[model samples]
Target: MIYKAEKFGEKYTTRWDNIDVDEILSSERLLGNYKKCLMDQGPCTPDGKELKKNLPDALKNDCSKCSEKQKINMHKVIDFFKDNKTEWWAELQKKYDPEGIYLKNHIANNRHGDKNDDKRDDDKKKEERDEMEKNDNKENSR
Candidate 1:
């Protein structure tokens, strides 16, 4: 059984950010475990099982009748990525990323980031040249 988010939830504007994880196993026992990690209180399901221990055969046997529950879980998956591909994430990405120049290209209304990037690079090169000139001046004075 394939646990597809599209099977339950509304289609998201952007594709799911499957940076690391992709599909959820529809096998009831495995889904029960993932639900445990995403929950805050009580068991992952109303039956009060599987979160701390494996679900009984009755609860972990199938998901044919789990449309609503699957929808709710898929919605959570989308919300979990709410900060992704947004301005806040773009800022953080440019700061931590080394090579990928995605912020200005992908983000909307982001001339500021590109402008600042160019300015910083120019300033760095100018600073290096100025320091070299200072060294040369000191050698001449000596």
Candidate 2:
């Protein structure tokens, strides 16, 4: 289930229905901080390098100051991401998920598996070459 930033202790660990978590997540400033922290520039890069590690959360804007509109912008975005499953919770990533919470296949968890898959092609090529060399040697001997 989606959660409010506060629920996980943006202030304290308590369930809050009055505060809109979506808005907090959707805040451009907050999202930008998330982008920098997660290094989620794009699906790929020319060099595929990561952004700097552990950008100070102090660099991100104070969520306590977020305006009402910023908060409202969050609702649809969170719902959209949850429904699509590609978008992710950069802010709420460490926030909280209650016990037995239902989960979805989001981009973050999926990316690690992708790196292993990228090696499959190289492995296949090496195997093919080894097989070809074996066949060539066998043919020459025959």
Candidate 3:
């Protein structure tokens, strides 16, 4: 498992692209371990550590450095988390997208053919706006 970035050129190495993403998605234990590793709540395996290191750049750049297979696998993992593990997904979002900079792109790209996802995202945006407005009102009154 050559996880080092040194060998990477224009795009990341494809060494780990063949990982069984569906197995991880479907296995509670594997999913939890990955979540913990990603969130720094538990120790990371070598591959997990590599993923953690690369995740921020991947999210920020919309996986621009990913190979096509990597992109598909990444989308599958992300969509699974978003749909099945909301709490873990929110934690990841808070860490990776604290300011919500990449959130719209994420939602737009990972809709997974679900129309209700758009409505969910819109409702989430409205709630966030409402919270921000309330905070502003409180600050202004001070």
Per-candidate TM-scores read 0.30, 0.25, 0.73
Q: Report how far residue 126 has shifted in candidate 2, in Å.
A: 0.8
Ranking by TM-score: 3, 1, 2
lDDT of 1 by residue, 1-142 (tens): 1132244443221222332233444244544454443343324532223212321111223222324443344333322332232443343334333243332232222344445557768999999999999999999999
Cα error, residue 132 of model 1, in Å, equals 1.0
- Locate the minimum summed-lDDT window of 10 residues in model 3: 1-10
Number of the top candidate by lDDT? 3
Q: Of the candidates shown, which would achieve the greatest TM-score relative to the real structure?
A: 3
Rank by lDDT (best first): 3, 2, 1
The number of clashing residue pairs in model 1 is 0
For candidate 3, lDDT tens digit of each residue in 1-142? 1232436456778888788888878899988888899898999988988888888888788877788888888777767777788898899989987887666676677656245586778999999999999999999999
Model 2 stretches with alpha carbons more than 4 Å out = 1-110
Worst ten-residue run, lDDT, model 1? 50-59
Which residue ranges in model 1 land beyond 4 Å of their true spot? 1-101, 107-109
